[model samples]
Target chain A: MSQFLQFLFSGLTEGAVYAMVALGFTIIYNASDVVNFAQGEFVMLGGMVTFFANAAGIPLPLAALIAILVAVVAGLALNRFAIEPARGASVVNLIIITIGASIFIKGLAQLVFDKRFHRFPAFSGDDPIRVLDATILPQSLWVLFGACAIFSGLWLFFARTLVGKAITAVAANRLAAELVGISAKRMMALSFALSAAIGAIAGILITPISPTSVEVGTLLALKGFAGAMLGGMGNPLGAVAGGLIVGIVEKMSAGYVSTNYKDAVAFIIIILTLLVLPTGLFGKARVDRV
Target chain B: MLAREEASGPAWLSVEGLASHYGRIQALRDVALTIAKGEIVSLVGANGAGKTTLLRTISGVQPASAGRIVFEGEDITTLAATARVSRGIAQVPEGRQIFGPLSVADNLRMGAYLRKDGEIAVDMDRIYALFPILAGFRARPGGSLSGGQQQMLALGRALMSRPRLLLLDEPSMGLAPVIVDQIFAAIVRLKSEGMTIFLVEQNAFAALSIADRGYALETGSVILSGNARDLLADEKVKEAYLGI
Candidate 1:
């Protein structure tokens, strides 16, 4: 029973990180219809930049803030230099651009920070807290709660704020958004900044428990994309649910089936889910009432 | 070219040597027209006569290859579409594009996004008065409304911007005649209340009847311009546009 509980806690922590990444994917997707493959790089940037900044004697909180700002700048630059120029391109073309951006970001990360795995000290210390005979690290709780806070905060932002509604408007119909005086381009840039901030926060939270390297973004992006696909492309609640489920399933499969085959679980879930619900668990099916 | 009657006031908006292109195809060519304040100037055209493109260029959505658009004697030829909104230019696009997931009232509120005044609630009330059905669906998602109701919502949303000059494109499209009448009545009422309107439509007779002056566009150029009554009575306009 304790073993099961341990796996659950471990799964939740991993799920929290994936959830944030999936959310970042959903935000950009909704606002601009682009699946930002560079999302994982933002996460890596958060951890890698802060890890070095702290090494250079910057306080952890300040370093974390700097990392977030850096990620936001990167996000805006990505939109301005890459995404905006390629506006009206085919979906496949846009996806390839993002993939290219991810590679470019990965290269830059390796250049700035070496190819070494790095870990930051936990926010509340490295103490292990026991709950019902299951020991979970304090950092895991932080990751879980941070993700929850982000999700709720986004919910309010989208539901109750004017700027949020404008973003929603842009996603619904870009031409209409412009007719009403809302700049779809500005909204797209804002979406990028927002997703980057979320990705960075995820990176900062998860670095304590799991060591990050320059190349961590590739696998994290692939796995987080799987979670997004499992949830439904543009559904926030689905993204979170799908990510948590993905995490738990991977951990369970690793514990019970085979540790080496753990990574295959995401593909399997995707294949099975696709075979049944091709629109995803929460994806809204395209239905034209004409 | 017909001489514009500027008896009331100088032109509130003028499009001079306006041209727009879609790759190899030119959608508008040297299109020139003017709308005086308090005038309902309607542009009537066939399915592909560049009527929509002209409206789009004036709204700053479609790029103008060569030309200048002047609003209130200020050159806004290079202004972005978003800045044009705060400049009191609001457009109701061809299809009523309501944000589907937004509530009816929330959708209305989005029109007032650039407004810093405290009269938004008051303006919202005015919109509700114009379309009473929208008030009942205040909390419902905008997409759930029927086509005619969606049109009403779109108009209400544009009015929320409190625009001095309103550009409406094919407002009567896909709507029942009674609903069209209601919308036209609303437009006339808006005009009477000091709103400058530029109406683009395929319904020539209906458009000219409400308009003080009319311009007819063919392919991508203005083929005819005159008093609305004169165009309605013209043999060429009757055969080509009014289906006489």
Candidate 2:
């Protein structure tokens, strides 16, 4: 029972990070029908930029803030220079563009930050707390709480705020949104910035527990995409649930089965889910009317 | 004969030598027209006659390859669609493109997106009163509403912006005669309240009956322009549009 609890705790911590990444995917995809493959790079930027800034004698909080700002600028640049120019392109062309952008960003990060895994101290401390005969890192609590807070904040933004609703209105119908004076271009930029900020928060929260490297973005992005696919695409709540499920499944498989095959678990589930339920657990099937 | 009754004020909107193209295909060709303040000016044309394209150009959705659009005596031919909307030109677009997933009340709120004043709530109440059925379905998703109700919602949404110039494109399309009557009645009410309306329709008779002035467009060119009553009685318009 203690072993199960231990795996569950680790799973939940990892799940929180995945949830944040999936959320980033959801926001950009909803706003601009484009699945941004560069989402994972924002997380890497958050961790690495903060680490390098802290090494340069900046305070931890300030470093994290600078890191988030950098990621936001990167996101805006990506949208303006890369995505916007390719507007009206086919969906496959857009996907290829994003993947190309992800590769370019990964290469840039490696050149600037070097190819070394780096870690930072936790926000609160290194204390381990006991829960039902299982020991869990205090940083795990921060990760879980951060994920919950982001989800709640996003929910309120989308539900209650005028700017948030305008973003949603653009997502629903771009032409209609423009007719009502909501600028779709501005909304697209805002979504990228918001998504980058969320991903940066995840990176900052999880870096102490899991060391980050420039190449970490590729694997993290794959797992995050899996979670988004498992949940309904474009549904924020579903993305969270999907991320948690992916994390728990991965940890449980590693704990009970051979650790060698643990990485394979997420992909296996993704394939099976796609075969059995293409729309996903919470995804609604789109109905196009004439 | 009614063409001799001069408009009481200067033209509120004027389009001159407007031409638009869809690649090599010209959608509008040298189309020119005007609307006086508080007048209901209807543009009657058949399908593919460029009525929708002209309205879209006026709203800044489609680019005009040649010619200029002036709203309120200001040259606004180069403005963006959102800018045109903010400048008080609101369009009830063809096909009633309401945000499907948003609630009816939220759809109404989106119409007032550019307004920052405190009168939003007051205007919202007025819209609800204008379309009483919408008040009952405030919580319902916009897509779930029937076609007629969605049309009403679209009109109400446009009105929520408190636009000085309302551009309506085929509001009576695909609706029952009763619902069409209701929409026309609402348009008449808005005109009485001093709104300048530019209406485009393939339903020529219904549009001309309510319009003070009317224009006949054919194959992307304005073939006839005069008083609504004169155009309604013209033998050519009768044979071509009214099936008289």
Candidate 3:
């Protein structure tokens, strides 16, 4: 039982990070029909930029803030320079463009930040919290709290605010949105910025535990995509739940089975989910309007 | 006989020598027309005609490859669609393209998205009164509405913007005759209340019967335009569009 509890806590912590990335994917995917494959790089940028900035003598908090802003600029630049220019391109073409962007960002990071892995001290002192005979890191709690706060904040934004509704509107019908004076382009930019910021926050939260290298984003992005697929692509709660399921499954497999199978868990889940529940756990049968 | 009534004074909206292309295929060619304040102007055509394309160009969704769109004398030919909405131009697109997942009330709220005034609530109430069925379905998703109700919702949505110029494209399409009458009556009522309307329809007789002026389009160009009554009685229009 204690062993199970330990794995659960570990799973939940990792799940929180994956859930954040999945949520980021959901936002960009909703606003623009394009799945931004570059989402993981935003997380890497958050960790790497903050670590280097801190090494340059900046305070940790300020470094994290600067890193977030840098990710945001990168997001906006990706939209303006790549996505907007290919405005009417097919969905497949746009996905390719995002993949290109991911590759480009990864290359740039490799050059600017070097090939070494990076980490920073946790926000709070490194201490373990015991619950039911299982010990969990204090930083895990922060990661969980940060994710819940973001999810709740976004839920309120979408349900209560006009800007939030506008995002929903754009996701529903681009032509109708434009007819009502909602700038779809601006909304797309906002989606990119918001998703990028969220990705950076997840990176900041996770770095103390996992550490980050330039290539860390590739696996993270793939796992995040798997989580989003499991959750149902467009729904928020699905993303979080899907991510948690993924992390738990991975940790459980590693504990009981082998660490060798841990990394393949997400990919296998993605494939099985696609073959079985293509619309995801939370998605509906959508009748697309032409 | 067609008597083209050229723009005599400062028109409410004017399109001069407008042309548009979808790739290499020209969809609208040298289409010049004008609408005055507080009147109904209809553009009538057959299935292959460029009526929808022209309406899209005026609404700034489809780009014009040549010519100018002047609204109250400001050249809006190159303005973005959102900017055109901000400048008091609203379009009820073909097929009553309501945001399917949005509630009926939310759909109307989308129309007033750019409004900063406190009158939004007031205007919303007025629309509910105008289309009483919508008031009952305020909490329902817009896609669940019937065809006629969706058309009413689209019109109400456009009106929520308090637009000076309303561009409607084929509102009567795919609706029952009774619903068509209700929509046309609403259009007439709006004209009586001093709204400038540019209506495009494949149902030529109904359109021209309510319009003060009419333009006949064929194969992507304006072939004849004159007083609605004259065009309604003309041999070419009657045979081609009115099915007389």
Candidate 1 residue runs with Cα over 4 Å from true position = A286-290, B1-11
DockQ result, candidate 3: 0.53
Cα error, residue B123 of model 1, in Å, equals 0.5
lDDT tens readout by residue for model 3, B34-69: 999877999998887999889889888889999999
What TM-score does candidate 2 reach? 0.97
- What's the distance in Å from true for residue A116, model 3? 1.6
Rank order (by lDDT, best first): 3, 1, 2
Q: Which whole-number lDDT from 0 to 100 does residue B141 have in model 3?
A: 83
Preferred candidate (lDDT higher): 1 or 3: 3
Model 1: DockQ score: 0.58
Candidate 3 Cα misplacement greater than 4 A, ranges: A287-290, B1-11
Reference interface contacts recovered per candidate: 0.59, 0.63, 0.61
DockQ of all candidates, in order? 0.58, 0.60, 0.53
What would the TM-score be for candidate 1 when compared with the true structure? Answer: 0.97
- Worst 10-residue lDDT window for candidate 2 chain B reads B1-10
**Compared with the true structure, what per-residue lDDT tens digits does model 1 show for residues A69-177?**
9999999999999999999999889999999999999999889889999998999999899899899999999999999999999999999999999999999889988
RMSD of 1: 3.2
lDDT of each: 0.90, 0.90, 0.91
Give the Cα error of residue B11 in candidate 3, in Å.
5.8
